[model samples]
Target: MTISPLETLQRVFGYESFRGDQQAIIEHVVQGGDALVLMPTGGGKSLCYQIPALVRPGTGIVISPLIALMQDQVDALLELGVRAAYLNSSQDWRTSRDVEQAFLAGELDLLYVAPERLLTDRCLDLLSQGRVSLFAIDEAHCVSQWGHDFRPEYLGLSLLHERWPHVPRLALTATATSATRREIADRLELNGAPHFVASFDRPNIRYRIIEKNEVRRQLLSFIKAEHEGDCGIVYCLSRARVEETAEFLCENGIPALPYHAGLGAAVRSANQARFLREEGVVMVATIAFGMGVNKPDVRFVAHIDLPKSVEGYYQETGRAGRDGQPATAWLAYGLQDVVQQRRMINESPGDDAFRRRLGAQLDAMLGLCETVNCRRQRLLAYFDQEIAPCGNCDTCLEPPQAWDGTVAAQKILSAVYRLWRERGQRFGAGHLIDILRGKPTDRVKQYEHENLTVYGIGADLSEQAWRGVLRQLLAQSLLAVDHEGYGTLALTDSSRDVLKGERTLMFRREPEKKARSTRSASARGKDAGIVLPPDAQQRFENLRVWRSEVARGHGVPAYVIFHDATLREIAMNPPASMDDLGGISGVGVRKLEAYGEEILRCVRE
Candidate 1:
């Protein structure tokens, strides 16, 4: 008795219908056709291959870059009553042997292996011995040589097609530009495969970029005011910053754990487990922490430092609001961030072409931060997707005023030029800001900078405003940070236009600061997008408590047992029997048989 794809979707994964191009992609793969799919996070990319694996005659082999997340992925599948297993280095000899035996005996439906392990001859031999329904290469962007998360192991994945010409192959990723997409197709030998590119927009996420002013205090205020008692991720550029931010948050009464490659494996694993298993645990980490995180309820993703490119920024921020709830993507950016990124690029070991590529990526990121237009519009355009201005971003919520800053640009460029031409010396932004505002400090007097004609010509603006002008000039390529690691400012070739009044400059006006609100914490749930009637809210909370207990007993994340969305639906409807519980969107036959009565009893109580 063969099952149809729609029947497999409803009976196995418990979804009523397919989204966007999911059904097409699945049908193509089920019929032994290759595909390259580009979808956003939480867009059900997994089901595209998983459903075909079930309906086909053999186990699906998923080549993932996320070795750390394989257990959780298999656990989630097991909960849905799917026969899933994984082969990775984390398992002991006996466990690996058992999984291998299961695969050879035709006992598993889907199997996940890291790209590194999958490339091994032994693993290939094992796979050849079993029937393979399809090959899914997750995170296909890693095949690009210039990507931030490049994995050299992925370059060998092209052999899968050669080795098994009959088995269909599917390549999937949540982030990739057109060039990267082409690179993946070329490298993986999928040139003739059909391409499916979904919309990259995540509308549930509200994007906000604030000036870095007492950033720690600002982050504290953001969490306290909007996302208290919520699971979130804070990204820093360096390990030292990760540790410091984690400690600061803890001292400020936020339960945070630091995660970086510097930590021991056990500590990293433990912190990651706590973050996934425990409720409201904030993981303060570097970029090392979030590649394959499956947690669905993270309410926010804040970055204290700027990301290297728009793709990386979009990927990190997309981790938020995965469950289709209101979430925040906040960034604290400032002049130092620009200086630091420039310094890193200048000092990188890459050659001229590589460095220029890095510089271009950084420039695009800076444009996003400085743009007065819709953030979402600019972000999606980078991926070659077009859309109107999203009303959810900070720019659309309160349109930033653009002021003609030609005079200010001239003042800053003139300062940099005089310091270089007249004094045969250079200065950083701090001294330059002081010189502009007519602050005759000891450093300014020592350098005789006060005697310069440009020193007191800009006393009309405040220090913050002057810094903003300098930052914008740097962003626009009118100014450059020196490579001497002293953070000194220098003029670029383009500065001549601004100095000669040939170029007009418009800068984003900094919004006026309002006093921080001291509102009570009664609105925390509402802030997390959990809105229900009083009785229903109570029931939802009760079900959550029960789910937590069940998850602990099973040694899996709470979301693996049941997502908040599913539980919320159950609470609102209050299922009367096993049949009613089985009718819910996320309940499959195996889950119904295993826990349907338990869910009904939990709801009634």
Candidate 2:
């Protein structure tokens, strides 16, 4: 008897229905058609291919990039009672041979292999002799060189379609702009395949960008006041910073661990395992972490430095609130981040066009940081999606006041011109700002800049306000950093307009005391919109404890045992019996049979 996709979904997994285009994509792929899926991070992209893999004949081959991602997926599949295995360098030779034998014997429902492993002759011979259901390429954006996570082996995926013309293929990615999308299709030879592009908006994530004052203090305050006892990620730019931040958080009584590429493989593995199993553990990591993490209850993702591109920022921030619960995406940025990024781009080993593309991406990210309008709308607009202002972001809840800075901008530009053009001396923003604000520091006196007309002209504005103007001026392309001159301020062609008084500069004033107080009150009130009653709140904690124990016993991630959403439902309703528990949204027949009685007991207690 053939089990349909929907039947399999309800039986093996817990979902009763498909989300977005999952049902349609499954049907098409099960009918032996190729597909290009562009879904959001937490939008159930895996179900689209996983269900089809099970319903189709033979074993579904998944080409994945990271070992952690593949292992996580396989573990989840095993929990769902699906036979899944992965081939990677982490496994021993004997273990790999056994998995290969099982695949050849048709005992496995799904098999995941890295692109490098899949391209090998041994794996190719094994697949050729066995019946292969289809090929699913996860993280398809990695095929494009322009993408943030490009993999060279992915460029060779075109051979899969060339060799197995009859086998259906599905290429999936959570983040891809229009250019990256086309590049992925062309490189993977999925040109004519149907594209299923879901909306890129992650509405549950509250986006907030704060100006940097005290980095560690701000992060600690946010965590203590807003997200105490939550599982979240703190992204740092360097490996040393990751370790330091993790240590700092730990010393401050927060359970924190560090993960980065610089760590030993075993240490990295252990840290990742602990983060997956433990509750309310904060992970401090570089971009190396959080890509393949299937943790659904990550309440926030904080960035200490500016991301290189908007796409990367979007993908990283999307890691938060995957369970559709309230989460936060917080970032702290300043002029130094802008200068540092500009210097790195200039120093990159790429041709003019390549650097230009990267520069454009950085510009977009800066625009989002400097935007005065709704954060969500501005972020979605980068992906070509227009959204109404979501009232959840910092800008939306507490609108910022934009003041005309034409006079101030002129004063700033004059300082840059006098310092570089007249004096033939290139000074960084520190000295330039000093000249503008008329601070006669040692450097100012040594360079005789105190005599310049523009010196102290910006004295009306505070130092922070002047910094804001310079940062915005850089973002607007009126002022640039001279990379060869150690990041000294330089006037771009556009600076002529601002200096000529032909262009108007509007800047977002620093957050007012009233707005800051309002934000603080809102942050203190946990789960503002989805506030649970006293009873439900206690029950939710009980459910979490139960989930952590069960997941530890089963040696799987807590979310695999049961999502926070599922537990929320159970806590709210307090299911009376097995039948009542089985009626929950995420409770499928398998889960109902496995944990229904235990769940009911917890709810009753």
Candidate 3:
């Protein structure tokens, strides 16, 4: 009965080996040590604590945030023949009482409960009666008030260490910057725990940032050309925008469902169920979604608006390519977005110091957007990670050309000054760019900007080129947005340098207006390409269909039946018997006994 972590991994969960630092973390925890694990979304963070919980003496207590997450994880553990259960509001009192009894009777190996529930006196008393194995805090990022997914209930989780001093604790998060990481440790009283920080590189996901032209059109073109029949998540900044974007995608032949807090609870649950059970169903959502989603085949994560910070962006995009397949993290931003974000930061209810911190976070994100270096390199640099050129992002694939934009920037800034300070009028980037590029538009004529001294003085650059210059100016702090004037451009102190010819400006050339038929991001990865020949690919698809049907019957996600990677291996090798199927990576003794014969039958067919 004395089983090692490696033995349990192969015999129970069906993995041949540990990934990255899982082995080390698991071994440390099994020996009564504490840890703070920072791993990427798909980096096997679960196994680190899961194995230790199984090998340790008593039931593992997991403090989770969401009911769906707790259910999905317990379902997966049950499929592996582990004694797992979850207690949350989703279950009635009878079911909750039964789970509690099972735990007290030593019938459960792992038990998950929400932080709010775990903080209750009754729940705390129940834990004191049992021989607890360890405490695993999932989504530890929520502990930080400055983080994107802050939950007030998580602040009380520090009691786990205080109440159960003898029990070792592990806190895990998919995304956390240095500041958030430090805050999690300080708040959770895990400052002295072993910190395991994995490389933040998601090599399978391609990063692309495009200047916003038209949001819907660009999103449609990208999806139609690159991910026609793929499952993905499209994130918007507002709930209203989420509904509109979901409807738009549905009207254009893409199956999309809207998910936001505005929707009824029943409707939101139904929509999420469809997204998980079906394939290629796009979920258009705001930041309210995608915390505990376990879908492994999300081919893309598109953002129609800028996120609050680089950590939020990284976490949102990290949802893609969870299965290590080729995926894309695409974003579309423009000048108006810059103004809107600044306004939000200024208008936040936080104090002056908090607002300053939020502003710094935005500045970091804007820096990533405007950097001339590799997108991945600049993004990782925000987390204090230095990396070489990724050669996969849009910047690395075709580096943007830079030019001496001093004269152009001055022309644009002078136009703003004349329109606001001299003429007693304010205009947005469109009108300012029009004046700079000498466009004969009705707005220009109606405002009589055509007769301004700065009008038509510099028409060397195209409209997009002018916009690019202005965007860079905003990013570089040479210009500010006058939100009271309906997002009119304003001159900053640094603008004086360029206006007085004291500074020379350099800006990256904008991308072409026409959409190019670029290769899919997955094409750059080894497994994203065709790993099997035509015949084997056919077999893999057939196995997938079979798995889907079985999962539906069992009311679980398809991956819980068998991951796509495991199915592909089975299809390629064509197991001749149950014995051969058991030899596969993900096929353990219990699963082989449950569905091995059926899988072999499908392979034969």
> What C-alpha lDDT values do all the predictions have?
0.90, 0.87, 0.88
In model 3, the clashing pairs are: none
Candidate 2 regions with alpha-carbon error over 4 angstroms: 513-540
lDDT of 1 by residue, 501-559 (tens): 99999999967766647532222453365678888888888889989999999999999
- The window of 10 residues in a row where model 3 has the poorest summed lDDT is 521-530
Q: Could you tell me which 10 consecutive residues in candidate 2 have the lowest summed lDDT?
A: 515-524
Top model number, lDDT: 1
Q: Give Cα distance to truth, residue 222, candidate 1, Å.
A: 0.5
Off by over 4 Å in 3: 423-425, 438-448, 483-485, 513-528
Better of 2 and 3 by lDDT: 3
**lDDT for residue 15 in candidate 3, whole number 0-100:** 88
Q: Weakest 10 consecutive residues, lDDT, candidate 1?
A: 518-527
Ranking by lDDT: 1, 3, 2
All models, RMSD in angstroms: 1.6, 2.0, 2.0
Residue runs of model 1 more than 4 Å from their true location after superposition: 516-527
Instruction: Report lDDT (Cα) of residue 83, candidate 2.
Output: 93
